[model samples]
Target: MAVSLKRTPLYQEHLSLGARMVPFAGWEMPLQYTGIIEEHHAVRREAGLFDISHMARIFVTGPAAFDLLQRTVTRDLSRVEIGQSAYALACNEEGGILDDLYVYHSGPEEYVVIGNAANRDRDFGWLAAQKRAGEPVEVIDRSDELGMVAFQGPKAPALLQSIVETDILSIPRHGCGYVDILGYRCFIGRTGYTGEDGFEVLVPVEGAVALWRRILNLDVRPCGLGARDTLRLEAALMLYGNDIDLTTNPYEAGLGWVVNLDKGPFIGRDVLAAIKARGASRRLVCFEMFERGDIARPGYPIYHDGREVGRVTSGGPSPTLGKNIGMGYVPVDLAVVGTRLDIKIRDRFGPAQVVRRPFYRSPSLGG
Candidate 1:
């Protein structure tokens, strides 16, 4: 017998909104409410809300919490200030990425690690196994007990400010703070996956539907996983399973900036150090079709000079740019901007060219 898929706290809310539910990471999630392109433009132009409760919220506490995390991720946790968040990657001993997550320093000796929905169990198990025989650190999985929602776009702050009593605009990028929303305590973070200015709100599972309904009353577009994927793709954000996996390393995925080799020892530090010294043979790059009508898709072969050089990892028609865009891995020498290539689609090859990172950038990002 097949195991039943999980449902988030807001599953009913999604159904009420006429969302087309589909299986994603072992859960029945909304693929689209209105439509992919319509929802995608809603986030880019105005504001949109997403049911992100599928993400894992794991908590670590005790005197040795910091030390345990220092040994588990690639970024240096010592530099992260209280109430601040940083993106980091957990890797295996061989330096292959296990998952990329956000770490928030909530308080002294208290931290929250938000892992990808699909990697929750594995991430929690990895952390639990690292507790030295009698260490004080505690790894607790709180994903099912809590709910998360993301409000994104240029007008997100204004919409959020109207609901909460806290001065949310005061929170800087990558910062987290506590606030009261309709009498419910919420953990709000100034971060998002859509490459826009937004906040990810975490609250008790019981309060999820209330919060979702309140946001819906504000005229915020209710987006689904389809738009979320497209928005992140146009932003050049790496997806865990597709863009990076056990066979891929941070250096080759264009995530070298997050690796801190000088911060002392951590999981995969030695191998990453060696890889950085030797240089990566291939790198992740963004590209766009030179001719219309040819769309790139995952697993499609990329060619240069009549030879297969790489394969597309994520690709789709960008609603914001109104063009076909995709990301893939290619030889380092041919990854430069302006380099022309071909993508095999069905019976013919379509012309494409390397472009700068991020096919779209919202004007509301820097403010």
Candidate 2:
């Protein structure tokens, strides 16, 4: 018998928008609303909204919360004060990535860990098991009780600021705080998967629809997984399963910046430290198709010279860049910018060149 799929609070809201539904990570999610390319451009030019309730929402609380998380993820928690969030990686003993986590220091002795949707059970179980016999910590899974939404794009701040009385723009990058969204108290973090200035809000399931509808009425286009993928790909942001997984390490995946070796010991610290002391053999690189209309897909073979050197992890047409771009793991020697390579598209090799990591950057990124 087939198992039943889960639905988010916005499931009916998505249907009302005539979204194309598809199965994703055991959840019935919207793949597209109008069109992938159209939605992608809408986010780049103005604003777009997404129901990200499928992602896992977990809370680690108690006096030992900080200590527990400190010994688990790669990012140092010393700098992450209350109202700030940080991107981190949890790894197994062998240094393989367990999951990429977004940790928010919500309050004193309290933290909210956002894990990948598919790894919710495993992540929670593993984290709870990591607590020592006397550790004062409680791991609570709130995925079913809460829903997530992402309002992304250049106009995201101004549009969101118009709704709530609080000044949303005051929150710096990676900062988070609770705000009243249409009178619903919700926690929002100034971070996003797409390389755009946006916020990810966590709200109670009961209030999700009201907030979603209110945002839609503000003229923000409802986006789907298709546009989300293309947007992140254009930014070269690594997707947990596609770009980084159990077989890939942080350094090899161009995520060395998130790893802090000078901090206290953590899970997989020794192995990761040793790897850093030496060097990673392979690195993830972004490449663009040399020919027009040649979109690369995941699992496609990458060739240097006449031999297959790597496999594409995440790839597709970058609507913002108006080109086909992809990311794959290749030897360090061949991952340099401007390196020419070929991607095996079905039966033929398509010419490609390793360009910079992000194929597109929002004009509002730095300034």
Candidate 3:
């Protein structure tokens, strides 16, 4: 029997826009509306709206909320004050990445974790299982009750500010606060995966459609996951299952900065510290195709020194840069910029060169 895929509250709105829906992480989501390139350029040059309600929103509350987070996440939550959010990782006992998530210090002794859509069940299960005996913490999955949307791009701030009551600019990067959106108090965070100034709003499921429609009225182009992937790739942001997973560690995945061994005991602290001391054998690096008419996709073989060393984890054409880019794991020595790599394309090999992460940056940032 085929299981029914879930749909977001904004599903109707997506359909109304003539979006092409596809199955993603067990959710029927928009793959594209106008076109991937058009939507991708809309975000880079202007603004784009995304329905990200499929991602899991889990809440940890009560007296032990902070304590439980400290024990489960890789980052030192002690430094995260109320109204601020931090990007962190959940690791198993072996120091393998369970998921990369954002932790929002929503209130006093209350935290909300936003995890990948595909890992919703597993992430909630792992967090719930960590509640100590007699511990007052409650790990609650509110994914079904809440809906999330991302308004991302250079112009996302001003456009979102026009609809919300709270001062959007006052919300620091990686910060969150309750704001009125379409007459409802929604949690808004100034964080995004597109390497641009953007705001993600967590609203009650009832208000999601209204809020989405309101943003669309402001001329924000409705973008699907296709554009989302290309935008994130230009920024060199790693997708969960592709770039990192149970078999991958943070250090090798170019995410060592999120791990804090000195933060005291956590799930994988001991193993991670040992791995840190010894160094990682492989590394995840971003590369760009040197030739036209060739693109690297996930699982494509990567070669160096005339031998197959690894495979592409994530790859696609970057509309913003007008180039084909990809990310893949390779020997540490071969991960440096300017290193030439060969990506197996069908029966032939295509040339690519290792480049700096983030192929695109806003001019306002002064790169």
Candidate 4:
């Protein structure tokens, strides 16, 4: 039987705005509100709001929270103090990533784990297994109780300051605070996926629509998944379902920097260490077409020396760069800057070259 997809509290508002809705990860989501480029620019130049309530939120609160998390995720949870967040991956025994997530230390013995919407069931099951094996943390799936809102762009801080009572301007990047909004305590984190300064707010689902209206009333345009996709692509941030999956390890996916083998024992530690020792064969790199015509896309063949070498994993037209940019796996020899190659787009191939990660850089983040 086909299960009915869920909708966020802002679904009616999206309809009122004539947003193009589509199914994404089993949710009736907004594909675009205004035009993709317009929404993209809104988030890049000013503030834009996103309804990311569909994303999974799990809480771990217990005396052994730190140690239990330490034994599970790739990053060391011990180093993350309260009010800070760290991005890490949950991997299986063989070093294959189950899902990539952010760990937010909410208190001394409390932490919230955020995961992709599609991986909620699988991730929860894995965490349950770990608990059964004597891992001392209590994992509670609180996905239904929370509503997540992302206010992003250059004007994000100012807009956020006007809504919530807290002084967000004083909060540094990656810093989080608790604020009262609509008579409820909200966990607000100054972090986002777009290559811009922003805040992600976790609030009670009951006040979600009111909060959404509050943001929209503040002149922050509503952005959809279409604009979100293009923005993240321009930033060269990896998407879980598109860029990497269960088979791809951090070493091969150009995310090796996030892996800390010296942080101590964790699942997939030995496998990652071995892969690091031997070095990776294929490396992920960003590239652009030399000419203007072809649109590079994922699964497109990459050619070097007239031979099939690699394949594109994520590609799209970047609104910020005003050009087609893509990321893919290529032989280590050809993954350097200025390495010329070709991208097979349908019946023809176009001139392309390998560049560096982050096709576009953010001056604020020192990218």
Candidate 5:
């Protein structure tokens, strides 16, 4: 039997907009509305709205909620204050990344953990299992009742400010606050995956359609997963299953900044500390194709001096850069900028050079 896919509250809205639907992470989501390249450029030049309710929103509350997060995730959540959010990774005991998520400190004893759709159940189970026999933490899966929408771009704030009563610009990067949108209570976070100034709004499921339609009235481009993937790749952001997974560690995936070895103790502290001391053998690097005919893709073999060194994790053509760019794991010695490598695409090898991560950066956001 074919497993039935789930749908967000905005499913009908997507259909009404003539979206091309496809199965992604057990959900029937819009792959594109207008077109991939057109939607991608819209977000880069103006503002684009995305239905991201497919992402999991798990709430952790109680007196021990902070303690629960401090032990499970790699980042030190104790330092996060109310209205602040941080990107973190949940790792297993062996220091392998399970999933990368965002934790928002909603209040003194409340936190909202936003995780990938594919890892929702696994992420919740991991946190629930880590609770001691009498721990006070309560892990609740509120994803079904909540709806998430990401409005991203350089003009995102201006667009959002016109809709909400609160001043959108007052919220700093990685900060979050509650505001009223069209008479509905919504939580807006100044965070996004596209490396642009934006907000991820969480509203009740019943209010999703209304909010989406209101944003649409502002002439915001409605983006889909196809454009989201390309935008994040251009920003060099890691996809959970693609760039980082059980076989990859944070240090090796170029996510060392999120790992706090000095913080008391966490699940992967010991192994991560050891890796930090010895250094990673292989490092993730971003590369741009020197030749234009072929585009690099995931699972393609990477070679240095005719020796198979690693494999591509994420690869595709960047809409903003108008060139083929990719990220792959390569030997530490060959991961430096300006290093030349060959990517085996099908029958032929293509010339590529390692460049800085975040292949594209918005001038408005600054370096």
Candidate 6:
């Protein structure tokens, strides 16, 4: 018999809000409410709330935690200061990506690593193995105890300020602070997947429903995974499983900035160094359809001079731009801006042009 999936604390609340739920990485997750386009626009214009509880939250703490983690991830954890977060990647000895995650330095020797839901088990096991190797790290899977909610958009600060005691307007991007939400102590981070100003609040699982309701009562629209995907895509953020994976490195995915080659030896340092010398064979590029009513999607063949050159990885109707935009990998020579190409949509080739990444620029949240 098939096993039942787990539900977040806000499962019932999502249902009550008329969310269209779907199975995501072994969890019952909301796909959309009031349609993907509406929810996507809500987070871009106003503010939208997301139940991101399905993401795994694990903590690594101990005297040797810093040293142990330094050997496992691509980023130089030594650079991350307390109350700050950084994007990191886990890699195998051969330099293949094991997973991409966000690492938060909660204290001097304590850290929180948020891994993708689909790679939680593998990531946990890998960290456990490193700890067993006598690395002074004690890994704890806090995924069950912690829940996360993302509030994003232009009005995010305003909505959150009304709920929290501290003035959120002062917190810098990538900064975090502790706040009490209705008797529950939560960690609020000024980070989000969408190209919008936002905060991701981590709270106790039991308090997730109450917090969700409170945000809803404040008129923050409930957004689902569908909108979340489109928003991130429009922002040119790479999705782990789709836009990037083990086969793709940070340099090819347009994330080379996150890798500090100048930093000392890292898990993928040698391999990345070699790649840097050789140069990437292919590059990720963004493109837009020329005419209206044309919808492009992943796996669609891209053509140049009537020959197949590459394929789209992520594409859709961008709610923020009100046009069809997409990301794909193509020959490095053909990845320049304004390069012309044709995208195969429904067996018909449509004209498109290569454009810059970050299809949308968010308004400044700092006052």
**Models, CA RMSD each:** 1.1, 1.0, 1.0, 1.4, 0.9, 1.7
- Poorly placed runs, candidate 6 (over 4 Å): 1-3, 365-367
TM-score of each: 0.98, 0.98, 0.98, 0.97, 0.98, 0.95
Candidate 1 residues lying further than 4 Å off, grouped into runs, are 1-3
What is the C-alpha local distance difference test score of candidate 1?
0.92
lDDT digits (tens) for residues 96-145 of candidate 5 = 99999999998778899999999999998998888888988899999999
Better of 2 and 6 by TM-score: 2
Each candidate's lDDT (Cα)?
Answer: 0.92, 0.92, 0.92, 0.86, 0.93, 0.86
**Using alpha carbons, what is the TM-score of model 4?**
0.97
| lDDT measured at residue 123 in model 4 versus the true structure, 0 to 100 | 81
In Å, residue 257's CA in model 4 sits off its true spot by 1.4
Give lDDT tens digits, candidate 4, residues 1-367: 8979899878998999999999999999999988899999898888899999998898888888887678788887777899899889998888888899888998878888889999998888776666646656798998899899899998888878876675778888888767898777898888888888889999998988889988898878999999888888888888897788888888888888778889999888999899889998888889988766778988999999899998899887887887888999888888899999899999998988887778887665666
Model 6 sits at a Cα RMSD from the real structure of: 1.7
lDDT of 2 by residue, 1-367 (tens): 8978899999999998999999999999999999999999888888899999999888999999999999999999988999999999999998999999999998888999999899999899878988999999999999999989999989998899988897889999899988988777899999998888989999999999999998889988999999999999988888988999999999999999999988989999999999998999999999999877687999999999999999999998888777889999999999899999999999899999999867888886872
Question: lDDT by residue for model 3 over 1-367, one digit each (tens)?
Answer: 8979999999999899999999999999999999999998898888999999999999999999999999999999999999999999999999999999999998898898999999999999999999999999999999999989999988999999987766778887898888887788798888988777888999999999889989999988999999999988888887999999999999999899999889889999999999999999999999999877889999999999799989999998988788899999999999899999999999999999999976877662344
- Model 6 clash pairs? none
lDDT of 1 by residue, 94-207 (tens): 999999999999888988999999999999999888889789989999999999999998899889999998799988889997789989988989999998999999999989
Q: Return the lDDT, model 1, position 92.
A: 90
Displacement of residue 51 (Cα, Å) in model 1 is 0.5
True lDDT of residue 163, candidate 4 = 66
In candidate 1 the C-alpha lDDT for residue 224 amounts to 99
After superposition, the stretches of candidate 5 with alpha carbons farther than 4 Å from their true spots are none
